[model samples]
Target: MSETEQNGEVTAQLVDGSTPATPEALFEKLDALDIPHRTVEHPPLYTVEESRSLRGELPGGHTKNLFLRNKKGGMWLVTCLEDRAIDLKDLGERLGGYRLSFGRPERLMQYLGVIPGAVTPFSVLNDHQDAVQMVLDSALLNHDPLNFHPLDNARTTAISPKNLLKFLEAVGHYPQVISLD
Candidate 1:
């Protein structure tokens, strides 16, 4: 196994090249909840499509996540499949917001401790204030197993959809799951 793998940095523990992450802290939290997961590390990609193309034939339905905020700077989590086309305006309305836009990179780092490409539900671990409200695309919940960034951008982790819920529970955040359609 590679050094990164040995350190749990490669696979499921994938991290951002720019962020100095505490994998031990993350794993410790996961361990506390006994959440089952596996990781794969790689060079970082600028887009979710790029990440998907690079991660061919993975075991689960990989999701593209978006961290956004309204005019009020209220944080929101948007998880969806690669193929889905989201009308952000409609999404904003469905989310009960008058307006929505991409949140600032600074806020991303502040609340989630993640930069843009590194946004993942695992980032919730860093949001100690519970400042971010999660909104999971319902379609994603149907995926038996799901893939997501493990608090960083350079790696991806696959875990059961149910286990994803367990992980969220472990974080003490209950996501408001909704359907895009």
Candidate 2:
């Protein structure tokens, strides 16, 4: 079946269907959950600087997602304001010991099914093993809407902050809200 048709059928099944396996499939999951969102297709963004140029066109609280792992292999997906300063040393303490480092590209793909620039909470849908812990910056949560790449840096998806939590829960991820300030 065509991608569009598959997505349509997936939406028809709602939350009863399996997790989305592709970026397009992710949208289908969102639709199935009745969560409102806006997607803007744009040039691929690898860094915050590249994405900043499109800020005017996209309205919402933008996020930068980090995939981190400790020496013990405890993995975390941290999402915060695009401009927020994250002190890995401090965050490591909060997350419980052993200094955290960015998970390798291959590891990211294995866990989140996304490339480096595409890391987002939405990627958790691809984590069928439920191995990654999710963290949301309390500062970013104050915003009504949140924006992140939808498993692909070429597109940005915006959804209300409350809906983000709902989406995370639907995907079996329990997000920890912490102050990254």
Candidate 3:
């Protein structure tokens, strides 16, 4: 790991450029962007129910991310409140695409640089091609602090709602926030 201070904030870079940012590196980027955040380490969580068991009293808008693709091959990363009910059929129409289905694990890895259990908005950083469209539920933005996996399922990070948008924009993803009700 290499650390550098730029514009008054410290950032960490991976020694190997070929690998995606580790949880620590992701925290460094958040710090460099001046995006306030808190991270908690835990055993890997693959589902919302599993995460809820470990999150305990952490207060924030916990999220469940879906890696999806349209029939035409367009991809999307949809992040929403963990309890929100998402109808893939309706979402496909709203997104103006053919029926959407869960993206394959290989495609998810190719686009987001994370495996099935680690889907996250933070993974946008690894999308050097900017090929994945980001869809955020408006309700998640309504929370003061939004929580997500930091490109890894073994931990969760919370950032202010506004700062979440800032981080996404910085990573070349302009999120589309809509009502997921």
Best model per TM-score:
3
TM-score of structure candidate 3? 0.88
Predicted candidate 2 versus true structure: per-residue lDDT over 53-142, tens digit per residue: 865667779889999999888899999998998999999999886599999886777677777888899989977878899999998878
Badly placed stretches (over 4 Å) of model 2 are 1-20
Model 2 residue 120 distance off true place after TM-score fit, in angstroms: 0.6
Q: Name the regions of candidate 3 deviating beyond 4 angstroms.
A: 1-18
Give the TM-scores of the predictions, in the order they appear. 0.84, 0.87, 0.88
* Model 2 TM-score, 2 decimals: 0.87
lDDT of 1: 0.75
Candidate 2 — worst ten consecutive residues by lDDT sum? 10-19
For model 2, state the Cα shift of residue 5 in Å: 24
Per-residue lDDT of 1-181 in model 3, one digit per residue for the tens?
3446779985543323345567788888899999889988889999999998988888978899999998788999999999988899999999984699999886776667787778999998887778899999998878878888998898888889999999999998999999999
